[model samples]
Target: MSAVAGKAAERVAQEVPAVQFRPKKIRTVAYASAALLVVVFAVVGWLLGDTPTGVIFRTSDQIAMALLGVVLAGAVLLLARPRVRADAEGVEVRNPVTSYKFAWADVLKVSFPDGAPWARLEFPEDEYVSIMAVQAVDREHAVAAVRALRELHKAATR
Candidate 1:
Protein backbone atom coordinates (compact mmCIF):
# COMPACT_ATOMS: atom_id res chain seq x y z
CA MET A 1 0.00 0.00 0.00
CA SER A 2 1.11 3.58 -0.64
CA ALA A 3 2.37 5.54 2.40
CA VAL A 4 -0.51 8.06 2.28
CA ALA A 5 -3.07 5.28 1.95
CA GLY A 6 -1.50 3.39 4.85
CA LYS A 7 -1.70 6.46 7.11
CA ALA A 8 -5.34 7.00 6.21
CA ALA A 9 -6.08 3.38 7.04
CA GLU A 10 -4.32 3.69 10.38
CA ARG A 11 -6.33 6.78 11.23
CA VAL A 12 -9.54 4.96 10.52
CA ALA A 13 -8.46 2.05 12.66
CA GLN A 14 -8.13 4.22 15.73
CA GLU A 15 -11.22 3.57 17.79
CA VAL A 16 -13.52 6.33 18.91
CA PRO A 17 -13.67 6.28 22.67
CA ALA A 18 -16.84 6.41 24.71
CA VAL A 19 -18.18 9.89 25.30
CA GLN A 20 -20.89 11.65 27.30
CA PHE A 21 -22.45 14.91 26.14
CA ARG A 22 -24.41 17.44 28.13
CA PRO A 23 -25.44 21.04 27.58
CA LYS A 24 -22.99 23.32 29.41
CA LYS A 25 -24.61 26.71 29.48
CA ILE A 26 -28.07 25.32 30.06
CA ARG A 27 -26.92 23.22 32.99
CA THR A 28 -25.13 26.14 34.61
CA VAL A 29 -28.15 28.37 34.21
CA ALA A 30 -30.49 25.73 35.53
CA TYR A 31 -28.44 25.18 38.67
CA ALA A 32 -28.12 28.90 39.37
CA SER A 33 -31.81 29.51 38.78
CA ALA A 34 -32.79 26.65 41.03
CA ALA A 35 -30.67 27.97 43.88
CA LEU A 36 -31.93 31.50 43.43
CA LEU A 37 -35.54 30.37 43.37
CA VAL A 38 -35.13 28.40 46.58
CA VAL A 39 -33.46 31.28 48.39
CA VAL A 40 -35.98 33.86 47.21
CA PHE A 41 -38.92 31.69 48.21
CA ALA A 42 -37.48 30.96 51.61
CA VAL A 43 -36.81 34.63 52.29
CA VAL A 44 -40.25 35.73 51.14
CA GLY A 45 -41.90 33.06 53.22
CA TRP A 46 -39.97 34.06 56.32
CA LEU A 47 -40.79 37.74 55.85
CA LEU A 48 -44.50 37.12 55.50
CA GLY A 49 -45.97 38.68 58.63
CA ASP A 50 -49.54 39.63 57.92
CA THR A 51 -52.05 39.53 55.09
CA PRO A 52 -53.93 42.58 53.81
CA THR A 53 -57.02 41.22 55.61
CA GLY A 54 -55.20 41.18 59.00
CA VAL A 55 -54.58 37.41 58.87
CA ILE A 56 -51.15 36.56 60.34
CA PHE A 57 -48.87 34.15 58.49
CA ARG A 58 -48.03 31.15 60.66
CA THR A 59 -44.77 29.23 60.74
CA SER A 60 -46.39 26.33 58.93
CA ASP A 61 -47.43 28.67 56.15
CA GLN A 62 -43.90 29.92 55.83
CA ILE A 63 -42.56 26.39 55.63
CA ALA A 64 -45.17 25.50 53.00
CA MET A 65 -44.16 28.45 50.85
CA ALA A 66 -40.53 27.48 51.08
CA LEU A 67 -41.38 23.95 50.15
CA LEU A 68 -43.33 25.20 47.17
CA GLY A 69 -40.24 27.02 45.97
CA VAL A 70 -38.21 23.87 46.30
CA VAL A 71 -40.75 22.01 44.22
CA LEU A 72 -40.61 24.65 41.52
CA ALA A 73 -36.85 24.57 41.56
CA GLY A 74 -36.89 20.83 41.08
CA ALA A 75 -38.95 21.35 37.96
CA VAL A 76 -36.43 23.84 36.65
CA LEU A 77 -33.59 21.41 37.28
CA LEU A 78 -35.17 18.99 34.87
CA LEU A 79 -33.92 21.15 32.00
CA ALA A 80 -30.36 20.19 32.92
CA ARG A 81 -31.03 16.44 32.91
CA PRO A 82 -30.72 15.84 29.18
CA ARG A 83 -27.65 13.77 28.34
CA VAL A 84 -26.20 11.52 25.63
CA ARG A 85 -23.82 8.64 26.18
CA ALA A 86 -22.17 6.90 23.22
CA ASP A 87 -19.76 4.02 23.03
CA ALA A 88 -18.65 1.27 20.68
CA GLU A 89 -21.71 -0.73 21.52
CA GLY A 90 -24.46 1.85 21.16
CA VAL A 91 -25.80 5.26 22.04
CA GLU A 92 -28.20 6.35 24.73
CA VAL A 93 -30.21 9.55 24.55
CA ARG A 94 -31.86 10.98 27.62
CA ASN A 95 -34.17 13.89 26.97
CA PRO A 96 -36.03 15.85 29.59
CA VAL A 97 -38.94 13.42 29.76
CA THR A 98 -37.88 10.43 27.67
CA SER A 99 -34.94 8.09 27.14
CA TYR A 100 -33.85 5.97 24.18
CA LYS A 101 -31.09 3.48 23.55
CA PHE A 102 -30.02 2.35 20.10
CA ALA A 103 -27.27 0.19 18.78
CA TRP A 104 -24.92 1.60 16.16
CA ALA A 105 -26.39 -0.68 13.54
CA ASP A 106 -29.82 0.73 14.18
CA VAL A 107 -28.83 4.33 13.63
CA LEU A 108 -28.68 5.41 10.03
CA LYS A 109 -27.01 8.73 10.71
CA VAL A 110 -26.34 11.57 13.11
CA SER A 111 -27.90 14.73 11.80
CA PHE A 112 -28.11 18.41 12.74
CA PRO A 113 -30.08 20.22 10.10
CA ASP A 114 -30.13 23.95 9.50
CA GLY A 115 -31.91 25.87 12.25
CA ALA A 116 -32.28 22.69 14.27
CA PRO A 117 -32.43 23.11 17.99
CA TRP A 118 -30.44 19.94 18.64
CA ALA A 119 -28.88 16.92 17.03
CA ARG A 120 -30.72 13.70 16.25
CA LEU A 121 -30.03 10.09 15.37
CA GLU A 122 -31.90 8.98 12.33
CA PHE A 123 -33.12 5.44 11.98
CA PRO A 124 -34.92 3.29 9.47
CA GLU A 125 -38.57 3.92 8.65
CA ASP A 126 -38.26 7.65 9.21
CA GLU A 127 -37.90 7.39 12.97
CA TYR A 128 -35.38 9.55 14.81
CA VAL A 129 -34.24 10.24 18.36
CA SER A 130 -33.58 13.78 19.44
CA ILE A 131 -30.29 14.36 21.24
CA MET A 132 -30.99 17.29 23.45
CA ALA A 133 -27.58 17.15 25.07
CA VAL A 134 -25.97 18.42 21.87
CA GLN A 135 -27.81 21.65 21.51
CA ALA A 136 -27.42 24.38 18.92
CA VAL A 137 -26.66 26.87 21.68
CA ASP A 138 -23.47 24.98 22.43
CA ARG A 139 -22.10 25.67 18.89
CA GLU A 140 -18.65 24.12 18.53
CA HIS A 141 -19.14 21.62 21.32
CA ALA A 142 -22.24 20.29 19.67
CA VAL A 143 -20.52 20.07 16.30
CA ALA A 144 -17.62 18.08 17.71
CA ALA A 145 -19.93 15.70 19.50
CA VAL A 146 -21.97 15.04 16.38
CA ARG A 147 -18.81 14.45 14.36
CA ALA A 148 -17.50 11.96 16.91
CA LEU A 149 -20.80 10.16 16.96
CA ARG A 150 -20.85 10.04 13.15
CA GLU A 151 -17.35 8.62 13.08
CA LEU A 152 -18.35 5.93 15.52
CA HIS A 153 -21.37 5.14 13.42
CA LYS A 154 -19.29 4.97 10.29
CA ALA A 155 -16.78 2.62 11.85
CA ALA A 156 -19.43 0.40 13.36
CA THR A 157 -21.42 0.15 10.18
CA ARG A 158 -18.34 -0.88 8.22
Candidate 2:
Protein backbone atom coordinates (compact mmCIF):
# COMPACT_ATOMS: atom_id res chain seq x y z
CA MET A 1 0.00 0.00 0.00
CA SER A 2 1.07 3.63 -0.52
CA ALA A 3 2.27 5.70 2.46
CA VAL A 4 -0.71 8.07 2.11
CA ALA A 5 -3.14 5.16 2.13
CA GLY A 6 -1.50 3.69 5.20
CA LYS A 7 -1.80 7.01 7.03
CA ALA A 8 -5.46 7.31 6.11
CA ALA A 9 -6.12 3.80 7.38
CA GLU A 10 -4.42 4.64 10.66
CA ARG A 11 -6.52 7.79 11.05
CA VAL A 12 -9.70 5.92 10.44
CA ALA A 13 -8.77 3.23 12.93
CA GLN A 14 -7.98 5.82 15.60
CA GLU A 15 -11.36 7.47 15.12
CA VAL A 16 -13.21 4.23 15.89
CA PRO A 17 -14.08 4.19 19.57
CA ALA A 18 -13.93 0.98 21.57
CA VAL A 19 -16.78 0.77 24.06
CA GLN A 20 -18.16 -2.23 25.96
CA PHE A 21 -20.86 -2.57 28.58
CA ARG A 22 -22.01 -5.54 30.63
CA PRO A 23 -24.12 -6.38 33.64
CA LYS A 24 -21.26 -7.04 36.02
CA LYS A 25 -23.15 -6.12 39.16
CA ILE A 26 -26.12 -8.19 38.12
CA ARG A 27 -23.92 -11.18 37.41
CA THR A 28 -22.62 -11.03 40.93
CA VAL A 29 -26.19 -10.96 42.17
CA ALA A 30 -27.02 -13.92 39.97
CA TYR A 31 -24.26 -15.97 41.48
CA ALA A 32 -25.44 -15.16 44.95
CA SER A 33 -29.01 -15.97 44.01
CA ALA A 34 -28.04 -19.32 42.59
CA ALA A 35 -26.13 -20.13 45.72
CA LEU A 36 -29.09 -19.17 47.86
CA LEU A 37 -31.37 -21.35 45.82
CA VAL A 38 -29.09 -24.31 46.28
CA VAL A 39 -28.89 -23.79 50.01
CA VAL A 40 -32.63 -23.46 50.35
CA PHE A 41 -33.21 -26.64 48.42
CA ALA A 42 -30.69 -28.50 50.50
CA VAL A 43 -32.35 -27.37 53.69
CA VAL A 44 -35.74 -28.33 52.45
CA GLY A 45 -34.54 -31.77 51.39
CA TRP A 46 -33.02 -32.42 54.77
CA LEU A 47 -36.16 -31.37 56.54
CA LEU A 48 -38.35 -33.58 54.39
CA GLY A 49 -36.08 -36.59 54.26
CA ASP A 50 -37.18 -37.89 57.65
CA THR A 51 -40.86 -37.81 56.83
CA PRO A 52 -42.86 -41.06 57.31
CA THR A 53 -43.71 -41.30 53.60
CA GLY A 54 -42.46 -44.34 51.67
CA VAL A 55 -38.82 -44.37 50.62
CA ILE A 56 -39.62 -44.33 46.88
CA PHE A 57 -41.86 -41.30 47.16
CA ARG A 58 -39.37 -39.46 49.30
CA THR A 59 -36.54 -40.21 46.89
CA SER A 60 -38.53 -39.10 43.88
CA ASP A 61 -39.59 -35.94 45.62
CA GLN A 62 -36.04 -35.07 46.53
CA ILE A 63 -34.90 -35.73 42.98
CA ALA A 64 -37.60 -33.51 41.54
CA MET A 65 -36.70 -30.67 43.87
CA ALA A 66 -33.01 -30.99 43.01
CA LEU A 67 -33.76 -30.80 39.28
CA LEU A 68 -35.96 -27.76 39.79
CA GLY A 69 -33.24 -26.02 41.74
CA VAL A 70 -30.75 -26.58 38.96
CA VAL A 71 -33.12 -25.30 36.32
CA LEU A 72 -34.02 -22.19 38.30
CA ALA A 73 -30.37 -21.36 38.95
CA GLY A 74 -29.52 -21.71 35.30
CA ALA A 75 -32.40 -19.48 34.29
CA VAL A 76 -31.41 -16.78 36.77
CA LEU A 77 -27.84 -16.73 35.55
CA LEU A 78 -28.80 -16.53 31.91
CA LEU A 79 -31.43 -13.86 32.41
CA ALA A 80 -29.01 -11.59 34.25
CA ARG A 81 -26.23 -11.89 31.69
CA PRO A 82 -26.29 -9.05 29.17
CA ARG A 83 -23.68 -7.19 27.16
CA VAL A 84 -23.41 -4.27 24.73
CA ARG A 85 -20.51 -3.34 22.50
CA ALA A 86 -19.92 -0.58 20.00
CA ASP A 87 -17.25 0.49 17.54
CA ALA A 88 -17.14 3.08 14.78
CA GLU A 89 -19.00 0.73 12.50
CA GLY A 90 -21.88 -0.33 14.66
CA VAL A 91 -23.17 -1.78 17.94
CA GLU A 92 -24.13 -5.23 19.23
CA VAL A 93 -26.57 -6.05 22.00
CA ARG A 94 -26.76 -9.42 23.76
CA ASN A 95 -29.77 -10.10 25.91
CA PRO A 96 -30.88 -13.30 27.60
CA VAL A 97 -32.61 -14.84 24.62
CA THR A 98 -31.51 -12.80 21.61
CA SER A 99 -28.71 -10.73 20.10
CA TYR A 100 -28.89 -7.81 17.71
CA LYS A 101 -26.48 -5.70 15.67
CA PHE A 102 -27.07 -2.24 14.26
CA ALA A 103 -25.03 0.19 12.24
CA TRP A 104 -24.20 3.51 13.86
CA ALA A 105 -26.24 5.40 11.28
CA ASP A 106 -29.33 3.41 12.24
CA VAL A 107 -29.20 4.34 15.89
CA LEU A 108 -31.21 7.51 16.39
CA LYS A 109 -30.92 7.90 20.16
CA VAL A 110 -30.06 6.22 23.46
CA SER A 111 -32.23 6.66 26.50
CA PHE A 112 -32.41 5.39 30.07
CA PRO A 113 -35.65 6.81 31.18
CA ASP A 114 -36.55 7.37 34.82
CA GLY A 115 -38.21 4.36 36.46
CA ALA A 116 -37.37 2.20 33.48
CA PRO A 117 -35.78 -1.20 34.11
CA TRP A 118 -32.94 -0.64 31.67
CA ALA A 119 -31.61 1.55 28.86
CA ARG A 120 -32.82 1.53 25.27
CA LEU A 121 -31.53 2.43 21.81
CA GLU A 122 -33.98 4.18 19.51
CA PHE A 123 -33.82 3.73 15.77
CA PRO A 124 -35.81 5.10 12.88
CA GLU A 125 -39.48 4.16 12.35
CA ASP A 126 -40.05 4.46 16.09
CA GLU A 127 -38.38 1.17 16.80
CA TYR A 128 -36.06 0.56 19.75
CA VAL A 129 -33.92 -2.13 21.32
CA SER A 130 -33.59 -2.78 25.04
CA ILE A 131 -30.17 -2.72 26.68
CA MET A 132 -30.47 -5.22 29.48
CA ALA A 133 -26.87 -4.75 30.52
CA VAL A 134 -27.39 -1.16 31.67
CA GLN A 135 -29.95 -1.90 34.35
CA ALA A 136 -31.59 0.35 36.88
CA VAL A 137 -30.42 -1.89 39.68
CA ASP A 138 -26.83 -0.84 39.05
CA ARG A 139 -27.85 2.80 39.44
CA GLU A 140 -24.86 5.09 38.88
CA HIS A 141 -22.85 2.55 36.96
CA ALA A 142 -25.73 2.01 34.58
CA VAL A 143 -26.09 5.74 34.06
CA ALA A 144 -22.40 6.13 33.29
CA ALA A 145 -22.59 3.33 30.74
CA VAL A 146 -25.52 4.95 28.95
CA ARG A 147 -23.71 8.29 28.93
CA ALA A 148 -20.59 6.74 27.45
CA LEU A 149 -22.65 5.07 24.72
CA ARG A 150 -24.39 8.33 23.87
CA GLU A 151 -21.05 10.11 23.60
CA LEU A 152 -19.72 7.43 21.31
CA HIS A 153 -22.82 7.64 19.19
CA LYS A 154 -22.39 11.40 18.81
CA ALA A 155 -18.76 11.07 17.81
CA ALA A 156 -19.52 8.35 15.30
CA THR A 157 -22.41 10.28 13.75
CA ARG A 158 -20.18 13.34 13.36
How well does each candidate superpose onto the true structure, as a TM-score?
A: 0.87, 0.81
lDDT tens digits, residue span 4-36, model 1: 655644554466777889998899999999999
Colliding residue pairs in candidate 1: none
Q: Alpha-carbon error at 13 in model 1, in Å?
A: 9.5
For model 1, the superposed segments whose C-alpha errors exceed 4 Å read 1-14, 50-53
Clash count for candidate 2 is: 0
Question: Model 2: per-residue lDDT, tens digit, 126-145?
Answer: 88999998899888889888
Top of the candidates by lDDT: 1
lDDT on C-alpha atoms for all candidate structures: 0.88, 0.81
In model 2, how large is the Cα lDDT of residue 19?
A: 84
Model 2 lDDT at residue 141: 86
Evaluate model 2: give its TM-score: 0.81
